[model samples]
Structures are given as C-alpha cells and as structure tokens.
Target: MVTLLEHCRIGPPSAAAEVSLPVTFFDMIWLYFHPIQRLLFYEFSCSNSHFLETIVPNLKASLSLTLKHFTPLAGNLVHPLIGSSKPVFQYKPGDSVSLTTAEANEAFDFNYLTGNQPRDSDDFYGFVPELPPEKIELDSKIIPLLALQVTLFPNAGICIGFTNHHSIGDASSIVGFIKAWSSVTKFVGDEQFLSGNSLPFYDRSVIKDPSGLATKFWNQMSIFKIESLPLNFPTNKVRATYILLESDIKKLKDLVIFKRPTLVHASSFTVTTAYVWTCLVKATAATTGDETDGEGTEYFAFAVDARRRLNPPAPPTYFGNCLGLVYTESTHEQLKGNDGFLIAAELIGELISKKVNNKEEILKDAENWISYFGELLNERISGVAGSPKFDLYDIDYGWGNPKKFESVSIDGDGSMSLCKSREFEGGLEIGLSLSKPKMDAFAPIFFGGLHADDSMPINPKENF
Candidate 1:
C-alpha cells in the first residue's frame, strides 16, 4: 500500500506571459498515443522527517526553477474538437505541473523493485502519478502534458516517476528537461550554469512541414481515440532488464560482419536491437507455438531523431518532437533461422544506412505512417522506446546516479527500452515486458546466445 502525502502544484518561479507552441507533423504522430512513463530509483537512506524537510523542498524549488525555462511542460495540449486547427501546447500564467508525493509501505522492497530480474508489472503503478484531469473549454479539449510522482520507501530510498504526453515532446526533449532539473537541484536551484548549456530552443518553426504532413497527420488523428489520461497497462505481465556488455555487443557485431561481409552500419544500436528482436521472436514462438510455421511476417519499428536530419538542421537543444520512423519487416522463418541474427542485423543496418544517408526521403512514407503503425498494433510487431544516446544514468540530483532506470511505457505495447548501461561503459541496457512464461523462455535464449561461441551458428531453439 502507498499513502498519499501531499499534492504540490509546481510552476515557474514567477508569473510569465502566455506562450503557445504549434504542434508539428512530428508531434502529430503521437498526438493521441499513451503518455510516456519512466521511473528513476535513487538510493538515499534517510528518515521520513528528513526527506520531507530537506529533499522535498530542494526538489520542489529546483523543479520550479527548471519550469521557468520549460514552460510547456507545465502547460496543456489544446486540441480543437470541432475544428481543423491543429493541436497546440499552450501555457498560461497560472498553469503548473502536478507533483504528487507518496510514501510506500514497508512491504515494498526498494532493492527488489530496482533489480534487473523480472518483477510484477503492477508493482510500478504506485509510483506513477496520473495527469491532471482533462478539460473541455470552448470546443477545445485541454490535456495535461506532464505529471510527476516522488515516492519514499521509508528508510530505503526514493523513486521518481513521470508521465508525459508523447505529443509534448520526444525522448530528447524530455531527457533535456530531466538533465536541467537535476543540474539545478545539484546546485541548489542555481540555473546560471544552464544559460547556454542546456536551455531548450522553443521555436516550433524549426520543424518545417513543406509536404503538408501536419494536415495529413491531423486528419488521421480523427480516427484515433484521444484519451484524456494515459491508458492503463494490462496485468499478468512481468518487466525485466537485460544488459549487453561491451564485449557482448562486440561479439554480436563481429558475427554480423562475418556473416554479411559487405554489410554496413553495424553500430552497437543496430546489432543489439537485432539480437534482442530475434530472441523475442523465438521466445514468443516457443511459448505460444504461434508463428512457428515460419511463414508469418515479423516487424520491428524504431524512431530516429530528425533534429540533425532536417534540411536546415535544428539545434540539438530544440524542444518538441523531431523524429523519423524506421520500420522494417521479415518472415518469421527468416528471423528464426540459424542466421536469424545476421539477417535481422542486415535488414536493420540497410534501412538505417538508407534513412540516415538520405534525409531528403526520410518522410517518404509520412502519409502512410498512421495507417502503417496502426496496422502493426495487433500484429507480430516489436517497437523500441528510449535510446542509448540519452545517457539517462548520468542524470543526478546530488543523490548520486540512479541505481536503476526504467521506461515503464513499454508495458503498454510489448516494446523494448534501450539506454546506456548504468554500470558498464560502452554497453547497452534493454528493458522488456513479457508474460511470466515468455520471460522464462526468453532469459535462457538471451543469455545463452551471448555465451555461445561466436564462431558457431546461433540456434535459438538449441539455446533454449
């Protein structure tokens, strides 16, 4: 059980003028999707009184100061229900982000909850706060963009969780806000160091939709059920974290190169994702006996940051979503074959190479994005959330680096989360949510494949 301590309304340091940021085509892709949720656990032993006295005040103050720069986070997404005006992120003087403080009972184990082993997915719901209830005003539905929760495990530690509307921003934009918040907290709310270093560029015009993709995407949103709050994830699922050490990643990359001598773009991201994708496919097949016929099509989708890929590249500090989707597909048989990893790697590498090298055609499939993604929702698809480039572990509010970081949104869709490993340099962390049986089947295949000699062919069934 968790006890609600207090609900604080955190806003900017002082009243600021109203601001509105236009939702671009990039943002429309996720306009009605479930909000992204994440949890960062830090180990700090202190009494409840000390926590409320020192930690709570510092976090609240630092967050308020951080909000002065990221005003949209404390704002709302205004979507006209009866008209053609695209959604806009609007911030008014009195707007603030909801910050909920809660205390978990002693029954909850901080260490077990932060471990890499499979844990009940429901265990995390307590740490995630709900977005402010949506409001309808003058034909426009107002949706809160972000909500936060700071949960204390008594004498154990603290877990900070946040849920944000995906339309408000992508990983890059949100991670920037986190880094800034941590910086201010570490310096006791001194934002002087963030002036030019991490200040976000809120100019929405940097994202150009010359092809009128914004209108096309908005039209597509009409078919989606836009929820005021994030949809609840189903139960009977367990979340687990896996790591690909530097050496493990190198082994996978070497195998890909050895199999496909001419292949290009076998970066750590591509190879690691491919290996995990293959394992997931086989693990699912092993448990359900579905797709074992080998003729079914399997899909893998991920997003690429378009900040630098744009025609007139936007600054890395540019706020909002600037992403391009990269979707790939192959036969289940091909992915389950002896050379499955190589095949998956080649397909991903080829597409990534094409996407990155030819920015002019990045949105060639923009018009079909909604339909394409919608179709895969109920299909044999595996998408990815987060990215290793975010370096999430480096985020610290003077409590030392996070003992564990989790992208909880992946539970909504069987998507995986990728980030830099907290303990291993040059390695990657992969988080997955699967049923207990599938997780049971996945563990051996994932770890066994890595331990298998690289010179030998990888057989998922044999690994199991």
Candidate 2:
C-alpha cells in the first residue's frame, strides 16, 4: 500500500504569461493522448526523520524555483475545435503542476533497487503519479501537461516520479527539464548558477513541414479513437534490468563480422538490438508453449530522432517531439531460427545506416512512415525505448546520482528501455517487462546467450 501524505500545486516563483505555442509537425505525430511516466529512485542510509527534515523541504523549494523557467510544464495543452487546426501548448496565469508526496507501506531492500534483475511489477507503481486529463467542458477541456509524485520509503529510500503528456515534449525535453531541476536543486542559493545552465528552447517555428507530413500524421492518428488508458497497475507482470558489457557488445559485433565479414558498419546499437529481438521472440515462444518452428510473425520497432536527420536540422535544444517511429517485420521462424541474431542485425544495421546517412530518405517517406505506424497500432508489436546516449544515470539531484532510473510507461507498450550501465563502463543496460512464466524461461536464455560460443548457424541477408 502507498499512503498519500499530502497533495499540493507548485507554480512558478513568479507570474508569467506565455503565448499559445504551436505544436510542430514532430509534435503532431504524438498528439495521441497518453501520459509518459518515469521515475528516479534514491536511497539514503539515514534516519527517516533526517530524510524528511532535510531532503523534502529542499526538494519542494527547488522544484518551485525550477518551475519558474519551465512554466509550460506547469501549464496545460489545448487543441482547436476545428479538426484541421493543430493543437497548441498554452500556459495561463496562476496555473501550476500537481505534486503529491507519499509513503510506501511495503519494504524493498537496496539490492532490489540496484540489482539488474526482475522485480515484482507492483512494487514500483506506488511511486507513479496519476496524471489525469483535464475536462472543463465538452469543447474547451485542458489536459495537464505534467504531474509529479515523490514517495518516501522511510529510512530505506525515496523515489521521484514524473508523468508528462507526450504531446508536451519528447524524451530529450523531459531529460532536459530534469537536468535543469537537478542543477537548481544543487545550487539553490546561486541564481547565477541556475542562469548558466541550459534552458529549454521552445521555438516550435524552427520545425518546417515541406511535405505537409504534420497534417498527414494528425489525420492518421485521428482515424483511430483511442480510449484513455486506465490507471491500474499491470497484473502478473515483472520487470528486470540486464547489463550488456562493452566487451560483450564488441564480441557480438565481432561474431557478426566473422559470419558476414563484409558487414563492416555493423554497429553496437544494431547488434544489441538484434540480440534483444532474438531473445524476446525465443522467450515469447517458450513462455507461451509455441513450437520451436512457429510460423507466425514478430515485429521490432524503435523511435528515430529526426532532430539532425531532417534536411535543415532543428536546433539541439529545439523542444517538442522530434522522433519518427521506425519498425521492421519478421516471421516467428526467421527470428527464432539459428541465424536470428545475424538476420536481425543486418536488417537493423541497414535501416539505421540509411536513416543516419540518407537523411532525405526519411523526409521523403515521412508520410508513408506515419501510415505504416498507424497500421501497426492494433498489432502485437515489441520495440525499444530510451537510449544509452541520453545519459539518464547522470541525473543527480544534490544527494547523489539516482540509484535507478526507469521509463515506467514503456511497460504498457511492451517495449524495453535501454540505458548505459550504471556500474560497468562501456556497458548497455536493458529494462525488460514480461509475465513471470516468460521471465522464468527468459532468464537462462538471455544470460546463457551472453556466454554462447561463436559458430551459430547463419541465414543469408535478403533485404540488404
């Protein structure tokens, strides 16, 4: 059980009225109604009275100061009544972000928090905030852009969780916000220190839509009337974190090269994604009691950052959504076969190479990509979320670096979150969600595959 200690609203330290900012083409793609929640857990080996006396007060104050610049985070998102008009993010005076402070009834050890293995899915939900959509009336309803919750585990630890609407911003923007908050929290008295930090760049005009992909994207999404997801915790679901050492990644790449010597550009991202894809499918087959040579289909998808991929790239600080959903399809047999990892690697490698090198290609096919994702919306698909490049672990809020960081929302989408290893240098950490039975079957295969020898069977690459 989780006990809500208090509920309050945190607004900017000062009043500011900002214009109704237009949502960019990139933002329009993700206007679908959903809250993306993530959490950072911190453990302090001190008395409960010490934690509440010292940390809570500073955390609340710094959060308020942080909101001074991040007013949009405290604001709400609004859409036009006309179907053709794109939605805009609006910040009204006196508006603020909802914050809740809570205490958990269950006790979990630091090993459970720090270990890279599965935990009871229910254990973490107490930390997540309920980001309810706003509904003033039939036409003029406002959806809260962000909400936060901080939970105390007595003397054991504390967890800071945030829930934000995807339409408000992408992962980068969210991380940027956290970094700013942490900076402010660290240098609470130094206004100059806060001024020197990176502020959010909210100029949506920088996004150009020559292909009219925004309208196409919005229309594609509008076709499907998605119901708001319930606030229920997942049942019988388990989450685990696994680390792939830098050496392991290199070995995997080398193994791929040994099989396909000409594949020089096979990357760490490609091989790691391929390895996960193969493991997931095999695990799925085993958990569900599917035959070894099952004939159905499986799919893998991931978001591609288009900030630099576009023709005239958006600024590094350009806020709002700037990701394109990219996915590949495969047969169950192909992915579960002996050459599964190799085949998966080639497909992922070729696609990534094209995306990174041939920027114009994605721009040209932006419309098609939107349509393609629409079709997959109702299908059973698995994909990857979060990236090691984001440096999620570095988000330190005064006390120390977070003991663990989780993209909790990904559990709903059945996708894995990838981050750089916290303990091991040059290693990749994967966050996975599966039913207990599947996880029981998955652990051995996942770990054993890491130690598997070279000389696995191969299937020739057909697409590349």
Candidate 3:
C-alpha cells in the first residue's frame, strides 16, 4: 500500500562546509546504537496541485537551510581504527542526508491514525525510511546520522518521518531541530526567521562526566552485540495510544494519596507511570507469568533529563545525550494488592525527589549504576520513552500541527511513549506496546481503575 516516489540527497543548501567535532563523554554513550526514529502524520485535504506546487518544494528547501545551521546532522558518525579510539562525528565538504518521498495507495483514515484501539504494527512501517549503512573507508567507518521520509496519502494527508543517530543528540536536540525547521518553513522568505531562535550548541563539553560514566557506558556496550532497529516490514506485535484526561489523572492522584497519606511528589508522571506499571504486571500475571513465584520483581525505569539537574547545569541548547536513568523495583503481589498503587508511586516519587535534591550524589554514582541499569533493561523492565513536555502536537510545519505523533521504534525496546494530550486539556497520551492477549487483559483493568469511585476504600481482598 505504499509507493516510493523519489529518493534524493539534501545537502546544506550552501557551499560545502567541512567540520569535525569530537564526540564527548555524553555523546559516546549512544555510540554503536541504532538511530531513533519517529513519524508525524498530518491530515490535509488540500488539492494535489497545492501540495506539490507549494508544500513539497517549501519543505525540502527549508530543510536544506535548516541543515546549514545543524551541520552535524548533515554529516556522519565516523568510527576510528580498531586499535585507535572512540568514534567521532565528522562532517566533510561533500556530506549530505537522504530524503525519500513516497505516496500511499489508500486514503488516510482519521480514526486509524489516532485511535486507542490496537492496530497491526505493519501498518506504520511503510512510511518510515531505512537507515543507511556505514560508508566504509580504509581507516574509518562513516555512518549517516540522519534520514527522512515524506509520504502523501493523496487527497487525505501527509506523513513526515525522521530517523536520526542517537549519539548526535537526545530528544531535546531532535525536537529542537524539527522546531527550527518548521520555523524556517513558516517564514521561507524572511531572512530573520532564525535570528531569535535557539540555535544548537554542538560543543558537547557542557555535559561533564565527573565519574567517567561515559567510558564505563562504552565498555559495557562493547560487551554486547546490540541489534539494529526494525524497518517497516512486518510485525506480530500491536501498538495503541491511551489517553488520561485531567479528571482521570486527578482521581488517580486522589486515590493514591488516600491509600498512602505519607506519599510525597505524587505528580502526574509518577502516578500515571504507577497505574500503567500495575496494569502491565496484572496482565502479565493473568496470561503468562514472567516470574517463577507469585511474588516476582517488577521494575519501573524512567529517563531523567540532566540539563537543568546538573550541578553546573548544561545549556538548554547543549547537544547530545544528557540523560540519567532511574530504575525502581516492586513485587507482583505488592502491585496487585489494593495498596499497590501507592507503593509504586512512593518509590517513583522518592527517586525523583532524591535526584532533584541530590544531583551531585546521583551523578557521582551514575558510573557504577550504568552497567547495573543496562542489565536491568535487558530483563523484563518497563520503562518510559518520550515525554509530555515535548508537546509533539504543537509542531506546525506550514500545514497545521501533526494529526498523530508516535515514537514507532519503542516496540522492539518494550517501552511506552508519553505525550501531552492534543485537546489542550491537561492530560497525557501513552503509546503502549504489548501482545494482543496481554492488551485485551490490560484494557478493562486500566479503564476500570480510572472509573473507580472516589470514596472507594482500599480493599486488600478485592484485588487479591
């Protein structure tokens, strides 16, 4: 159902500007990893003439200019010799990015794009472009850092897909690039379009690894032969987006507070994460028990952005990964019990509070924790990806905001993606990945917990 229209190279619209930047400690953490990919679908019922004549050209041209500022993106991640050192981000005069254009055979379905119902993962793959392989050099390996695809669904809509090397930057850096590109597209002729914008800071020295956690991270990565991300081929797994409205979040918060009055920092992130973790655990228990005993350990891992949390805070524009992971544990029996909700919330809250209050201590200990965290992730750990803070729906690229935004790659990693509700009401959108059987069991439990009466007392026997 997807047809490729064209595959073209988009280099810096300007003359070749050769540049070489050292991959700092923070950047090294993501080396040898598959690039992160995301897709944004937008429904535009405009005439084909308007789209081809106006939108397409404008988008491609604007992206070219945007890359001029984000020069590193137009380059590659080059690995040094075997006996040499770590990889470095290299940009030569002839460096460029691949941009593919495609067309869908059928009309776009609004419901299918944004619905909560589970759908086949294969439905999304066609829109995503493949990540290019490394261009072998005698002394080094050159890997393309970014690839983009734009697909049109005829009189229905258009989808913009982005695939970027994780080592180039984190979510903040990627999102910033998209925002900048959109800004340029909006004001195509305005020379001042990028004047007031937040330019990317390519210098990775801002992220100070006092404990040399980056080297530890690299050593551990070398220990495992990590796999590449899945292309939009076919998948047996399914994905769905669930929304938690403001009212529903309030009730959940109130429920947790009532059960454990001593709980602190029961914010939206903590509470919502707890609810999802509990549902997954209960669902897994109902179908295929991952644990040998009725009481198995369940881990909840969440990524914390260390930009502002660092002792010598990193610049908002600082490029590369500046994130720390926090993994908390709970037991299946504890989560399935009536008081399980509060128990999970307390653990998540306490960790956040500690990280916020004791940034120095946490950063100091991150080196030792890197290997341990990686091992936990290798297990049955449920972590979160994408933050509501990104406000994905707000991405207006000439054509209005995206109709649906999803972190499609989360499927292979078994992590959930969170985004702010598009309705403007304070809410959260969670993109969860699970087998069909597990999803069926999780749906009712998740909905029922939300609709539970406010005055309902914590009954230990009810859940048991």
Candidate 4:
C-alpha cells in the first residue's frame, strides 16, 4: 500500500541480492531472516490481576515518547521475501504460557507469572513479505518506528513487548534503552542508558595475523555436524538450550573431578550442554519401548566467542556475529556406559578446549566456517533440520546469576528460545527458546537432577 506520497520507502523484499546485507549491516538484515532476534524479553511480575492495566499503557507511552531514541540499527525490523519491509505498528497478543497459570506455577513456578494473547499488529511488529533496501527507516506507527505488543494472560501477570533490530543496538544496549524507556514511563531512573558505553570497533583485521593467539585458537577447533540421536523414541530429541547454574554445576564438576586419570572437566558451558544432553539420553531411555538398550546416539552443539581470540579480540560490545559453532557427537550406548553424564560432559569440554587452545586454526578455517554457516543457513531456509543454535543470553547486569535460563520452542521447527532463572529469590533473568516436544522432555530431566537440591525452597506452585 505504499504510495508516491509515502514519506518513507524500502525496496521490494526478497532473500535475493536486490539488497545485500553486508557484514557491516548484518544487524539490520538479520531480523529479516531471523526476526526472532529482534524480540525483547519481558517479564511481568505483578500481584494485582490488573498488571496490564498498569503496564501496557506505560509501555506504549514509553516507546512512543522514546521514538527518537530508537537507533536505525535497533529500529530495523523486516519480514523476509516481501515488498517494502515496513515495520508492523500492530501487536498480536500472544496466547498465555503453554501450561495453565496454576499448572505452570506447580511446574518451575514463576510465582504465578501469566499473560494472554498478543494484541494488534501495531503493538507487535508484523511480518514483512521480503527484504528491502538497508538504512531505510520504517514508517509504521511512529516515524522512528516503535512497536508495543501487549500479552494479557488470565493471571495478573502481563508482558509489554518491544523489538528493535540489532542494527540499532545489541542485547546490552537494548537492555539499557529498555531500562531508559521503563524509567521514563514508570517514573524510575535512567542509569541503564546513561551507563552504557559503546563496544570496541568491528574490525576483524585483528584476526589477520594467523600466528597470533586468535588464529591459533581457531586452528584447533572443529565445527562438526551436530544432531540429536533418538535416546529412546522415534520422536524424542533434545532441543538446544545454553544453561548453567551454581549448585548442579558443582555436581557436574564433582563427577568429573580426579587425577590425570581424572576427567577433562570442561567449562560450565560444555558441562551444562553435556548434562542436558545426557539427561535427554537418560530420560528418553526411561520412556523407551525397550528400556535396556541405552546405546542410542545423543548430540548437541555450542558456539565459542572468538572476539577475544583475535589479535586483540573484538571489544565485548563490538557486537554483530561474533560466534563460531563447535559440536559434540556420540552414540547413546556410549553415553549410557557407566556415567553417561560424565562421559558426555568430558567430551564436550575436551573438544571445546582443544579448539580454543589452538589459536592458529581459526585464521586458516575462518573462511571455511563462514562458508559452512552459509550452507547451514541455506539448509535452514530449505527446511532442513539440525541448524546450529547459539545462546549468549545468560548475561547478568549486576543482578544475581540465574540457576538455569532457557527458551521454549514454538512453530513446528526445532528452533528453541528461553530465559534463565536467578538462583536467589529475585536475581537477574535469562531468556531463551526451544521446540515444544523437546522442551517437554528436557524440563523433566533438568528438574529430576536440579530439583534434587532441596535447599532453594522454590514456591510449591511456581512452574519451571
């Protein structure tokens, strides 16, 4: 419906080269292919059933008033393969959490957090039909483009959603900006935005020197194909989730502790991924038709931050695509032998370490990985499964750390998302996602192991 009178215009949208999403412009164009990245993680914890009554309007006003503050990078939200990728000013109210408010409370128990269907397209950024010219500001609801999605569930809980493409800012920056908007709208402080310092430059040239530590680290790592082998059922599979915690993390360390004969205890990232994978392997076996044969293949993948490996590593805030995927592969029979948890955990840790320890490998394999990911993306677009998933969302902003944060999946695709929960009563939060069936299987295994520690006194009604 764009007209000559339109003040803003973007070219027709398509994955083709009508417009190139250069590495420099990756943040903006990513939302076109991976729009979910543009979503804001919201947690509405209110006592009164009228949470939305107090929150939604405040969120709307904050976004509207803060329009000018929305960066071109953050403001860019695109729908893939459509015309003139305009921002959808409307918000589509998301349905309530997968489980009932009560059942959910009984589960992980978020103290009865709740919300209902999403509202208008203006509130939620609508899908674009295609990619368009880069750098064009959207002309949806606001000139600067701000979207307010309201999800009012049955309970008093509500979520005020906002999405600004990464081109405008990254997770940290968005957090700062959101805090600013919340401050103004809710009558709070603006320190969030005030304290945010820009990240270092985006120069990959630092990695140019292969002999340097950065390239050495890359040389050792192998980016292998990762997939979930059915631990038990034809349908059973472990979805991706990057989570870690203090207590169980200790348990993991304890299991791998020993001498040179001692296991190669991996970092929390490696152990946790393996822990989840083993849990999946074990749980699926529990649910299998033949409980005895534990020798099925179980697998998962994780990415390492290569920024620091560069001659100088990209600054923490340098942002964009700074991750490289590393995977772990093995059979269920192998995982089930003795302590599958320990074995899987060790393998993940050793593999990641080997890759990270050798810096020279990266420079040599940089282009190879780029090409690998490119092919991977093509496969994903073609609906092929097993695309690598990344999780760097467990960041704590001075808030206490989360025990475990994960995103639940939707759509039939295996894509995952979720948030990490703070160990303390109310610490910082983490968000992530995953597909449903896999999530259902994973939740049980995690609780079976994690809930073993009864000290937390989690609310009886709160769902995981």
Residues 180-226 of candidate 4 have per-residue lDDT tens digits of 55544544333444455532233434334333433322332223322
Off by over 4 Å in 4: 1-21, 24-33, 37-70, 74-148, 152-155, 162-192, 198-245, 259-265, 286-297, 357-364, 370-420, 423-464
Model 1 lDDT, full chain set: 0.86
Q: How well does candidate 3 score on lDDT at residue 214?
A: 56
RMSD in Å for all candidates: 2.8, 4.5, 3.8, 11.4
TM-score, predicted candidate 3 vs. hidden true structure = 0.92
TM-score of each: 0.95, 0.92, 0.92, 0.55
lDDT of 1 by residue, 1-464 (tens): 99999998999867677899998888888887888999999998878998899989989999998898899999999988886778799999989999999999988999999988899999999998888899999999999999999999888889999899999899999999988888899988655546647789998788877889888877777675333343464678999998887777888888888889898799998999999999999898889776366888899999889888888899999999988887899998888777888899999999998875577878778788877777677678888899888899988888899999988888887799999998878878899999999999999889777767855444333221
Pick by lDDT: which candidate is best?
1
How much lDDT does each candidate structure score? 0.86, 0.76, 0.77, 0.38
Q: On residues 27-87, what C-alpha lDDT tens digit does candidate 2 reach at each position?
A: 7666664578898887655455665687778878888888777788888888765556667
TM-score, predicted candidate 2 vs. hidden true structure: 0.92
Scored against the true structure, residue 121 in model 2 reaches a CA lDDT of 77
Clashes of each: 0, 0, 1, 94
Sorted on TM-score, best first, the list reads 1, 3, 2, 4
